[model samples]
Target: MRNQVLLIIVLLSALLGAPVATTAAEGISISETVLKMPLADDVSMDDAVDSMKLRANTLNFKLVAHLPLYKELEAMDIETNRIEIFQFCDARIANEMVIFNPDFSAYLPCRITLLEDADGKPWLVTLDLGKIIPSANLSPELLEKAKMVRDKIESIMQAGANGEL
Candidate 1:
């Protein structure tokens, strides 16, 4: 039965032309939709992004780009100042992952977004790398890199949530 399911997943992946997530029996989950961390009242968007930048640097993740979506939209006449995304990556870790599974490129340069709600409260939303990386069928070396990257990402977000530098 498990083999049959695996076959189906493989077939679907082949048709889609991208790696598909595999799930274990008994309804075991291997991935998450989004992880949210509430921001304190005193933490502005600028402050959060700056904190993330410092933390990412300390963790050895290069800051690829910081997208200011709110400003872009506002320039087009949308009223907003609350959506931004931080893109960071560790080339060593990414190279290890890509050498084994090039499909990992789909998630390269991990992005953590800062979103503000209507009530003026901010939140951090990010893909759960802890779940995604483990399920990627990576090699031992890539797996170790994944673990380290995941830990660093979580730490960065935690610092941002607590309004810490």
Candidate 2:
């Protein structure tokens, strides 16, 4: 119920074009919950995906899955812009996170989405690790691992947006 309320608040903020504000207790802002990056105009979706995969590999993160949601929607005769999700994971870190708190498994195998908005502009979107990391009360080593994961994901997003490996 609490999570649902937070989601509603975030969605309202996005829809109303309100500036992101942090929740005093959690120290989490709407911006930190939803990170979005616009893709360069010159970059093709294929190139962007390739760049993301290459960057993930370089960072030792495995590409666990690719979900072409738009394709699925099309199969159902639904009209929608291109939308795809890529899941990546560092198994060792993920295992440790889960061991630390079983609830953390829900966040395992981090995902990034590639989609076209109403204006046909491409974007890369993901949940900011900051939303959870700061509140997780992690030990030093675990915190470092989590931060590394966050940094690597950000690097992947940048690579995709810039079409750079």
Candidate 3:
């Protein structure tokens, strides 16, 4: 039978380390994370960071670090402006996540950057855990924790973008 013959071919190919056949070789993966949101029209870069910090504080995510990228660049004599990052964390949430998988530390103390483009409109950008969650193989409870943290992060970033909360 044709199906039997194909099965034999597939087994032999597997032994030879060949790729399995599929209808489309260019399938797009769902692991991609989309981040980056528009800032309030008339807001300045500093205002963006301020708004983000306020929102994070309201949610009990303590401020961890504030890195001024533009200033750091200037220290090396590179002329640039309107770029910095705000790092914060909720230890309880982070602890619950790590217990499920220590490898999740790579995403700890989440950060968001505030930057402006040529038009001087500020922007808030950060990575989405959903982008990395698929491969993380988290359990239902851990997945819920991840989503909870992710939701908080997105909410904070959006609040900062709107220059409110």
Q: Pick the candidate with the highest lDDT.
A: 2
Model 2: C-alpha RMSD to truth?
A: 3.8
Better of 1 and 3 by lDDT: 1
lDDT of 3 at 111: 75
- Candidate 3 lDDT over 1-165, as tens digits, reads 543354344433322223455445423221123366888776656566777888888888888988787788889998764677788898987897788767567567787767665566566766656666667788888778778778888988888887784
RMSD of 1: 7.8
Cα lDDT of candidate 3 equals 0.68
Best first by lDDT, ranked: 2, 1, 3
Stretches of candidate 1 off by over 4 Å are 1-31
Badly placed stretches (over 4 Å) of model 2 are: 4-32
Compose the digit string of candidate 1's lDDT tens values, residues 45-140.
678888888898888889898878788888999887478778889887777777776767767788787877666668887767766665778778
Q: Which residue pairs of candidate 2 clash? A: none
Which residue pairs show collisions in model 1? Answer: none
TM-score of each model, in listed order: 0.77, 0.84, 0.74
Per-residue lDDT of candidate 2, residues 43-161 (tens digit)? 98899999999999999999999989889989999998888889999999999999998878767688888888777888888877867789899999999999999999999999999
lDDT of every model, 2 decimals: 0.72, 0.84, 0.68
